[model samples]
Target: MSGQKACCHGPGYGTPLDAMKNGPREKLLYTVTVQPNLDEPHGDYLATVDVDPESPTYCQVIHRTFTNRTGDELHHSGWNACSSCYYIDDNAKQIPKRDKLILPSINSDFIYILDVITDPRKPTICKIIDGDVLKNHDVTAPHTTHCLADGNIMISTLGDAKGNAKGDFILFDTKNFDCVGTWTKGERKALCGYDFWYQPYFDVMVSTEWGAPRMFRRGFREEDLDDMTQYGCRLNFYKWSTHTLYQTIDLGTEGTAPLEVRFMHDPKRPEGYVGACMYSNIYYFKKKPDSDDFEAKKVIDIPAKLISVNGEKPKALNGMISDILLSLDDKYLYVNNWLHGDVRQYDITHPENPRLTGQVFLGGAICSDLKNVEVLEDKELKARPEPRYVKGRRLEAGPQMMQLSLDGKRLYISSSLYSPWDKQFYPKMIEKGGHIVQIDVDVVNGGMRLNEDFLVDFGKEPYGPTIPHEMRYPGGDCTSDIWLANDGK
Candidate 1:
């Protein structure tokens, strides 16, 4: 914290718009990368990449910090404080800065607190709250980590200690990272939980479901989709102040696996969007007029493609929209289709109708073996596009996770979804490892093109083949932040 400029707001730019206009450009990226298999001798770790173009080590992973345990399966990471705490009365003293990161293991139930204040580039582990601690609270399989308006941190838990589908929220102190008990007030009503978003101004919180730990730990099975007990297809809405589930909207089969939920960047607006991974669709949700609760409608749908490999019978493959995020300015929404190998940019100036402005393919099942594969869409035969190559190397794996720069000029993407899912859908990714690529965004015109010169190949690291997951910038980013101020403030 010596050289870092002090912020008047709690820990981030005052508002999403302020962040877009005033936030400094990112010089380094902190990424979570896991080994090829779950049984690695060395555990999953955080890899720091140099993003500054002028730096000598630009586009290279300069540092790696490994966790103590071997099989943690580290996923979505969050900060201890952000712009959301702007309204805290004593925020200047209670939340001095946003230096600590809360990283949770979806498999082991362990939580690691990392201190980046000493050095943002090379963060060291300050504390590790073991798996049993969370089990003691009757919650395991921690997924999303978020900081509330107060100094406390709230995380969404996917299952009970026995590995059953029990959706609950866990709370912990910001200073000690000690268990403050479950956040939900009464009995757990949600069948399962995955991702969540909150808007305090409207007193609303929306969470999506994604089955239990036992159902998806090993790998994804097609039969699991048919079993209601194994997979989830509903969205749960909660009262933000009371921490109680108020309503649930069943998306049916077409909206199975509603994974990531995102509210608009404007804190005043209650409208948002969710990505359904299994069904290949995006559903828009908003507060019903003259009501406190909400309703959801399907706004975008991607047709599944028929794929055949090695002269086998054609199989229908879903696009598998793994991740989505809105630009800080909230003018465009970006979505990635993991199976179809395409990242699409949609202009959402009108919240109800999204217009497609740009699209690009990386690599996926359809592009796995271009020469020997047959691809069809709807009822007509279609030719698969040639494989994408960057820096003379063929790009493998589809875009699974994405991070947009605060300025909305550059988009960063990682190719690995989860270790188990990576092995099932793209086995080659396990052998060669996942990679991170950069896509230059045309902010003025709303289009995207691959930046061929910038690439971070995890397969070439000192450690054996590893897969990169989620990413965050040292300063706040588009996906990891929420603003409490209204637009045009």
Candidate 2:
């Protein structure tokens, strides 16, 4: 595939080298962004871009490889480490042994093992796991995936085959790519499954859940909240070594739809964070100094700022913090407000007291209709886009599927939050597809600036519109790196 702004279809994939390796060099190679066809049965794919500004095709999607299957709602992805506690290869190829991105399907029990090494330009789906095998354990709908110390692919399941909310985990052996036994314990099952992050330093792992398969399979409804089975509000902690269920911290009602879990970068640190969508909260969690137990408290709350009229409420108040990314240095936190149409950067020097340093609004449902401006820290930012159907009300979309750079200076942004919600909230995304926008971070001061020149508009593709999701670089991402305390030996 030539370095054209347009996406190459049907094996137009070129050589898979880190386009950044040329000219002024950077640590990462190309950026692999996930793009799923949200409408009908067109399938999903990964769009590889030359993020290196020095490259001739900077910001252009150089390659694309599709899954060939559709309606799967391809979601999050991560590399399968050879060892549980070993560091990932610095300049190694994204293939088996070195690393293969294990991607899970949200609607079906299918997991794709992608081989980026065989052909960087056209990554091959080297292997696929039938999640139907998990049906024996009543497991289906796999969500978040992480590598264990022994290199097995650990996954969180959202529900059973019958669509019953039974949050648990399933595993796949890295050697054979076979589905293993369950990862969660029977005594401490969750209400539903969403996202998780593990810390080898503290020997602790934490997981969060959203609604059951039924509720999330479709756009959210106000009436669904009344049913206790539809949502979750707790954080589950597990012992990293044993996979034993540790203490579970209940956030009560305010913690509805707890998702996107993140831990501080340093192994020495015992704390991390979780983002709650329905209630619009980010909770900081830490291991108790007195014991191995864990505790989480809400550190930031995003209020409902998008009212359609002066006195009436908007269609949705889910200041849904759908995607979140922490800086490599652990000094800053960046989160997206999908329903509110904004992305915020916060300084977290003091984990308990984060200072909001910057914010940028893209588009939102209610706010776009009102077109109002908000003044924060002497800088006036519109809470909702005014005249242009500003806030995103007309577009009904905002930033989502966030990915931060190795240096944390460039935060890649996507607009697709969820399969069912993208259409209802961001209707045009179905016909026009999604987008990829980069936000330049003033790391020293905790501020943000949108990169006007960089835009990977999926809607503009020749194959119709495609919804972009979670993304990763060939190397150096918070999710891909794991520090093993004993692996130093």
Candidate 3:
């Protein structure tokens, strides 16, 4: 199989040669950008590009390859492009040929599965698992799909009304991509949105519901908006085998619209913690070994003073927490504030009580007065004074996804909001282009800092203003799954 050639179907997967030669390597990190244009024919958010360790440039197509446990080549295939426009090149030139070959029409509620060849040189898509084909099917919106440690696949579905089905979790046979079992959220009122992060090592999986159960109650006329108090983000926990909901933590009342939750563990610390970011605050949870559940420990409220360049406070930094990397020693936790325009590092040496030791401002503080371009427009407006200038370093655009090397030496960051669904709202916010930034991080005097000299720009590619959603390495799948591939022995 190693010597066999493969064809392309979606984005290919590649492993670092160093990891293969060493032993169990670090888990490859992947960030997925959902590109959905509501004005487009099909309004479903679809995966556009991928970022990984192999490329200096952040953008890459879905079709690619990855080596199996036996080191054999495997192909990845993708299906269902809602709005079928190919990504544009950096020069604004469209890849007309590739666009013509691939279908451009967006398929409503259609889910696409990707299978890539292991060999990089001849990678191709081997199969495409369609959502409609699954039993008790509903309208398809590709939510989150991840490969479990035991070689099984877990996919969350965004229920579609046309399909007359509610959102549920579907288990699949990884080798054959066959649907084996299904876990339904039942006829619950809440709308289960896309993507879930699985921690196979801990035998725990976490998922988020964009709108709380109360929202569904209102939609069903069971409750009125004035009576709806439980309508924000929800963090659900399930046991690995039965997918049973063992515990749930409701982020407070101020409409914290939690999007993504991340768990971080340090070999040095006996207790670990999970971090969740919503529309409001960034919450941290600590896992207790004695009990099967985790406890909500701390919440970092986003200061309302942080302003955007437009002179208005951002509605909400709605997107997955995007990327969270624990330092090699697990002493510091680095997190990218997707829409808040900052990368924050927390001192988690004491997992039970994590503290914010340091932070770097990027893309402008979410509360800066300079963001108010509207106020700036009024030459006669003197009531609201402009913010004083500060010179450190700022990310030109919001970083949607990020990747860190196993050794914790290199950091890759990609820009591009998943419009409408994530943030920015497509077509209307198309003025903003996408870019990838590479940074070098250094640990000094017990603190981590971004090395300014190592920035790399991925804006020269021809993939038409890319919006990088995720970044990974070797053979791992999503951001939460990143780990030592083989245990760098």
Candidate 4:
């Protein structure tokens, strides 16, 4: 399909490569910025940034649109429609365009829908899904949002209406943005939910676990690991068509708090990786060769660094593998160590054995040579590689969220993780505000370098210091777009 013809349908491109080759170049990006402090009641907002280097406002936030209320802690955002539901027949008229964006608040449980097509530079709030509405459907703490192939929307909620640690998926009609009740048929077997991905060809859907909202929203407590009800360390597999849980895999001690999950872009492949935050490990999973079961193995392990904490000497600090994603071509994998303050790229051509190819430091607590580090309730001394700088601005807060370009040439990253966790890990960075930077990819040779020419410092915004979370492009990005088996035709 020609690029021009593909743009007329939902999310356009028929395959990941097609999108990378023919998809439109990103000129603007919409990122969610949160006001972590409650005393300053200004509220979280969506920021519009000019990414076009040729523009006069290049590398600057051009506009900001706030959510309905304060203390929302806006986390992730996605489109209402994507290539998952590309129109194949005359029903193309009935299929919605890749326009509106669904932004969900992890703290307040509110979902804000924005009209991006109207003005890509400045998105306006078209509709807001109140927390009460989700509570009525027995779910809250809305997290990951993904467009379904059936012309509807599905979001993974961290808990039930009261936010008490139960994985329940909430559905909504894309056309009207109305709540369509829970996607789980009956009792949800999973204890927690954070990120999820589906592959219709395999008839499988995989989801990872996080902490209960009631506990996580307050802050991170090391003692919570002992309580099964407060934290989780398992992955749930479900039948995609029926949305029924069939199997559950316990990741044990080394896989505590499994967060992000990603499958290969190829529709026919059934392999992916999940990053375990607590233990700093990545597990690769795939279907059993001759059976109807799936198996996972620990393929990447990040060793802990010893640091002083609150006058105590020699304490092990986990890397806190916060986010992970695959390149559009599935040839490389990127991992972000929030606490260690570095991003590492791996060559995943062999799937099980991921070879570290490139690594670069941005902002992190342990990545510096300073003797004293000030985070909440801890004083540490570290002697590691000096932190890297861009355009004379010292990058603070380690890399958190990432979004890669379709063509696999550039990778964009944000620094803020979660507000509460950010307070515990990098409190000083919170006051200084979050930032967005670009990394030029060595796609051919497997490496990455900081694009010193580009930087979006949220600290400089007129709306006070804010922490930016997830980001999405006006025309679909590598993370937000998915292609079906028959989409290429």
Report the number of the highest-lDDT candidate.
1
Superposition TM-score, candidate 4 onto the true structure? 0.94
lDDT of each: 0.85, 0.69, 0.41, 0.84
At residue 448, candidate 3 shows an lDDT of 45
Model 4 agreement with the true structure over 288-329: per-residue lDDT tens digits = 987657898899989877667656666777779989999888
- What tens-digit string does per-residue lDDT give for candidate 2 at 97-193? 5457777888777888888767665667888877577777798878887776454788888887787787888888878788778887547677777
Least accurate 10 contiguous residues by lDDT in model 1: 1-10
Who is ahead in TM-score, 1 or 4?
Answer: 1
TM-score of each candidate structure, all chains considered together: 0.95, 0.85, 0.63, 0.94
Candidate 1 regions off by >4 Å?
1-8, 90-93, 378-382, 486-489
Better of 1 and 3 by TM-score: 1
As a whole number from 0 to 100, the lDDT of residue 416 in candidate 3 is: 51
lDDT of 2 at 65: 66
| Candidate 1 vs 3: which has more lDDT | 1
True-structure Cα RMSD, model 4: 3.3
Q: Among these predicted structures, which one has the highest TM-score?
A: 1
**Which sequence of candidate numbers ranks them by lDDT, best first?**
1, 4, 2, 3
Q: Per-prediction RMSD in angstroms? A: 3.1, 7.8, 11.8, 3.3
TM-score result, candidate 3: 0.63
